[model samples]
Target: MPIAPKHLKFDDGSVTIIGVDCATQSSKVGLALGSMSKGLLTIDKAMKVGKSGSIANVVSSWIRENSTTKTLIAMDSPLGWPIKLGEELIGHTAGSSLSTEAHQMFRRRTDFFIKEQANKQSLDVGADRIARTAHAALRLIDEIKEQVGMSIPLAWNSELRHPISVIEVYPAVTLKSCRLLSATSYKKESNGAREQIVDGLSEFMTLPEADKQSIIDDDDILDAVACVLAGSHFINNESVGPATTEDSALAEKEGWIWARMPR
Candidate 1:
């Protein structure tokens, strides 16, 4: 069967609500513009590459394919980096994540931790998937900001819902944020099929500007799209928890961090 179908109208929207996610092994893109729901998101594709150049390509392709969504891309990474890096890339870190470091936000949200668990079984911290995923998003955030001048959430404010406009999400440091983005989905072992998503995000982040030659993963974009949809969900629903308070995270059935949200 096919990994990603052509397209399905999920929700009806004046603006095409879209979300994007990045993972270690694969990438996911979601679209929530016009259908039955507020926003419709779905996985676009997945790929296998190891750096920024390849990930950007994946994103560009997806955007081109779904360019009609009046596209507003929601990404699941830090979008910006440290001062030194941010200034160079014209990006800054999202400030809200500090409330919860691993707050679940998008594919990267659960993805980072899921792979953290898998890291023990796959790439180990020395080559851990979570860090790698975060790094991949961070790198992409830098590149996208440099070229597109986007990504990076502002301070959290309830009035605006997420304190950021268009780009919505808590900073990566917030407690179990209610998102589904993470770079942990892909793992690098044996046939090296896991890291495919991560590599795809890297390529998409760079895009036509950098032009890196890495494999692509549509799943990364889909996951990022998930994060975006969730962000819009939080804004419209206003139930993502106090835009100013910390979230409640719970461990998995196995006694590990399974999921969390603002309480």
Candidate 2:
């Protein structure tokens, strides 16, 4: 079944938004925090994860500092494991019943949904390119949940109306929707590819050229910008790809990746 995107409602320009590109290694995570005021969006904070830095500390500190502001965090990570996979991991599945069909049966609805909408697919948390990152992300999620409380998923935020919210993000999918670059390109070590991405992003938004060039070699920073934009998109009611009816149960386990935001 195809997953439909969720529409979120927010008070006019009142929330501080944050975006994080979660990485298994702390040094690679990227963060962008900002807000929209009078219809003009501005990013006031940007950081590339350093070897000595901790993702938990950065997030916690940001929340603490912004205590008075309503907040929305858009993170690039899998917050939960697939339900069937979770059962198998916890020994809840019959040994004889741990079949491929069973795994397929519980595949995350959002993954298929994103593929259909963005022509991009997310890695399965159980076993995929992002598996390790997903594990690391879930740990951060637990810590943040304790500090900030359970976050409202994008799909549910419209009705629930929480002061703080979090939604899964995919930069490649987001970039594709924005038409800045193809999902498969611009994520490479080569200078040519990096320059292409940097140039593409520059065209979409007003960025400090010098600062933008400094992070051009690192796609992580570009993704951080993408995540931050996704957060802004959510706050602006421009985000798409939320959990559908069939996805509620799976989204509770495997988090939904909000796709289809224009720049």
Give per-residue CA lDDT, model 1, range 1-263, as digits (tens). Answer: 11122333322342333344555443232222211123333233323344434555544444445533433445444332222222233443655233322222122222344445323121221223545655665565454344433343332322332211234333221112332224444222222332343344332232222222222223333344335434544435432322211121221110111212433
**lDDT by residue for model 2 (1-263), tens:** 11111323445445666778888898888887666555555566667758987776677667656655566788898776676665565655455556446445445777777766766667766675678897887777677766655454444453226656788888887776667665456666765766766577655555554467645767787788778767766666666644466677667667777665443
The CA-based lDDT of model 1 is what?
0.34
lDDT score for candidate 2 against the true structure: 0.67
Per-candidate Cα RMSD to the true structure, in Å, reads: 13.7, 6.8
Cα error, candidate 2, residue 89 (Å): 5.4
Runs in model 1 deviating more than 4 A are: 1-13, 24-53, 58-72, 76-128, 149-225, 239-263
Q: Which stretches of candidate 2 lie over 4 Å from their true place?
A: 1-12, 87-97, 102-106, 145-155, 158-160, 202-210, 241-244, 261-263
Q: Which 10-residue span in candidate 1 carries the lowest summed lDDT? A: 250-259
Model 1 residue 71 lDDT score: 39
